[model samples]
Target: MQALYDVPAPAKLNLFLHVIGKRPDGYHLLESIFALIDWADTLHFERRGDGLLQRHDSEGANLPPDDLCLRAARALQQASGCGFGADIHIDKRLPAGAGMGGGSSDAASTLLALNRLWGLDWSLQKLKELGLSLGADVPFFLGGTHAFVEGIGEILHPVTLPEQRFAVVKPAASIATKEIFSSSLLAMSKSVAIVAGFPAHNSSENKTVDVTRYLDGFGKNDLQKAAEAASDDVVQALELLETKFGNSRMTGSGSAVFARVVQENGKSDPAMATMLQEAIPAGWQGRICRSLEHHPLKGWARD
Candidate 1:
């Protein structure tokens, strides 16, 4: 009997990303609060009796033949030595290279869904070991919770943040992560500290050093300066968003900027989401998404 498996690969917002330092290996130490969004790409997997991995979606057609999805499936198969293979399908909704963690999320979904479909029954720790090989952000998506991430983005600790609204805008252009990281203009120095008692502790100290406050005070994305310097379209799009939303900042490396705009009551705002979506510039894509406290399909994983 072939069991059908479907899972969601949710996009993420780097509520804010700070490059604290660069490592000898060229990987940058980062401090970021990553929140999952409602917008997600769906992946479906079907087990094949024969031991051969296959993909059935066109979302990543133009990506290199050896994309993360295929690589993930192959890696899982190799590790488990499962006699069965999977035919994978992806419905890509998130934009590519917008710093939304699309590819990494897809890879994490592949590892998780296939584990159950093949009856691998691997523990979360084991799953993470395999997932990290796919990408730094893969483990966070696999962990399936809002997180405070650090150390080249592999170390993840769940953090409680108030449910919030974000107006996300992706420029027509895609800024390559590698280019931004390697750019000479990137800011590579920042101090490290745990953002304790985020939105819940609205005390004067908390208010002074809260994630939103830190972001508003710092006005930094190590990659943003480099990315904007590298492309004019990105700068134009970011400028327009900042003009509309006063608290606007780039989400990840480049090309996608987000504005934090929760309601007066500190609740999610559907109207704001609608307005943000409608207000996208002629050549850009935008959405108003709520920060997800938990992954939508977490119940499915229990099956």
Candidate 2:
């Protein structure tokens, strides 16, 4: 009897991921600035008068039936006692296991949208608390702001990132973050840097770090060399992006590599985006996305 709404589950690119230490529970302590991109998977929520949560999809047949999206809806229902249900449809665009946080974003969006659609009217802090139980990255998406994240990513300091365009390429394989973190070759004992401008080629900065200064400075992925060593295709793709765009880095423990590029052509330069897409390897996927200082859900927040 209620209207259906389409919610976006945007993909994230970890500007840099630094594994500082391993927790006793095996979750690694990480420091990274997670940036949301324009590319996203979308979820549609249609309230069911019958109180049934149904999911139909045009893109993601591979995800298991008991997915986080449904779980999130159930979580909201139990948390709010809204006495409402919905049919959720997913239009998945981002690749799975590519470290883009596609599923987690979907779960976050589902919780946020349903909180509104079901008339629960929960606060952002409450939504983020619920989202954290779903996934590490889910809290960040629920916060709907760019953040300097720490403590296995529960701690967040909202940040304003400069508007920049990115060219992202995903190799044909997925690198598990857990596997990479547990690898002996992964850099663990490296001293954290007190970065004034940007991450020290591969370090994390505190909340006081200036956002503009960091943008001009190049950040590095500490797990990249290790992940690339596990997959030669990742190494090859990184090389292609760097050779073409000059500022390329792997996002998270990644098969996805992204490059910063200028959209406009001045001084007789080829559009970096146009060049990268045309040169994408035969077995790889690529897209151009503009960085966002805020997530779409910011508009929906109860404030």
Tell me the whole-model lDDT of each prediction, alpha carbons only: 0.76, 0.79
**Stretches of candidate 2 exceeding 4 Å from the true structure:** 59-61, 189-193, 196-209, 263-274
Report the Cα RMSD per candidate: 5.1, 3.6
Task: Residues 1-303, candidate 1: write the lDDT tens digits.
Answer: 448877888999887677887789888888777889987888989998998888777645456567898899999999988899888887878888789898899888888888888888887778888999889998888877787677788877676666777778888888888998888898865544534444221121212223434444453566788988888877776776677666777778867888776455543466666666676767677887778878764543442
Per-candidate clashes come to 0, 0
Model 2: residue 51 alpha-carbon error in angstroms? 1.8
Worst 10 residues of 2 by lDDT: 197-206
Best by lDDT: 2
lDDT of 2 by residue, 134-186 (tens): 88888888878777777788777666778878889998888887788767778
What TM-score would each prediction reach against the true structure? 0.86, 0.89
